[model samples]
Target: MQFRRTVIALLTLATFGTPATAEGEKAGAFDYYVLALSWSPNWCLREGDARGAPECAEGAARGWGLHGLWPQNERGWPSFCRTNARSPSRSDTAAETDIYGSSGLAWHQWKKHGTCSGLSSAAYYDLAREAYSAVTRPVVFRALDQDIRLPAGVVEEAFLKSNPDLDPDMITVTCKANQIQEVRICLTKDLIPRRCGTDVIRDCTADRALFTPLR
Candidate 1:
């Protein structure tokens, strides 16, 4: 009877042990990583308006932040855009002038092709000296968080297959703490794009500028 009891106990343990070991192996099979990026509000100002102005003005003004995780890239830099301002002027005026003046500084940093001609001649040329002074100002980029695990042979095949626009090299993995919360992907750059020959960045849907890579 004692021998029979011992054999039964050993069998029960083996049945559970096999599955538990397999579960551990599955969990440990792949490495995981998280990446994070943040941008200041200065980075959100319209690039066209901020042109020729010192980069520091945007940093000094109301700042904004953007965060995300992406796969590692060997040669790509983080990108951001400036915010757009609106005016009711038919041609040009003071309100439009102010908007252009502020946005040009931002454009200079993010859009290599930005110009400040949309403002009236007086306003456009008046701020040139100030813009030139801030021209050499450095814009800051920071990686607030990172949790990269060493490479494993296995990858998250499903995730890679679903997101094609995202560069595989810049793929980011995110985990939520609460089951009810949803993950969010945010575009931190200004939603508006720069005009062809204007310093103003408009917020109207019909006039929105599409983001292009800075040259």
Candidate 2:
């Protein structure tokens, strides 16, 4: 009788508690959540003293390096960071570390925060610029023909119109003389725009094809 009681107790403990414990452990393994800033490295630096720092530093510091505005998860873990960094100058070009830090910080932030919400006006402006860039000069754009015909000034207008919440100065457009096919758009936190020759341009051939001339 004693042996049977002990056996039943052991079975109940394993059947009722082990799986829940395992799942809880698995869920708890992830540590933080991330909020991505979309402004270019140049604008990121101009925004503030802390904006250009790597995400790891922001996460560690528990805010955008400003006082008393730290982000916290339900479990109270700090979840966001300013992981972007400026490109190394010619004198110090050998740095091979990630522009941010390890994948661990990003992973942890994502796990904890899930997604960022209720961004400040500055953050929203930065995010809008990123979305505009994604729609216009996406990474996939490079795969298209370099010589593909693109509409003139349409890229600039479209980017600006798409992001109305930003200040006018935040959306600057410029084109390259050598690569007439290229266009670049820049947005800053203070809502200033600075055109750069090296920036990618949006192509509007697909839109032009959708409208046909009537006889």
> What CA RMSD would candidate 2 show?
21.1
The digit string of per-residue lDDT tens for model 1 on 1-215 reads 99999999999977643322111111112112122221222233333235544423433342112122211112222222121323223333333223233443323321311111223333333333233222221222122132222222112223234434333333222222211011112111221111111111111222122221111
Highest lDDT model number: 2
Q: What is the C-alpha lDDT profile of model 2 across 1-215, one tens digit per residue?
A: 99999999999977654322111122223222212322222222333236444533322321111111112222323233222323223322112113223233333333332222234323432343343334333233223322343444454465456545433333333323312222223333222343321212223233321111111
lDDT of each: 0.26, 0.31
- Deviating ranges (above 4 Å) for candidate 1: 1-38, 41-104, 107-111, 115-164, 170-215
The regions of model 2 sitting more than 4 angstroms off are 1-92, 95-140, 161-169, 181-215
Estimate candidate 1's alpha-carbon lDDT, on a 0 to 1 scale.
0.26
lDDT: worst 10-residue window of model 1: 194-203
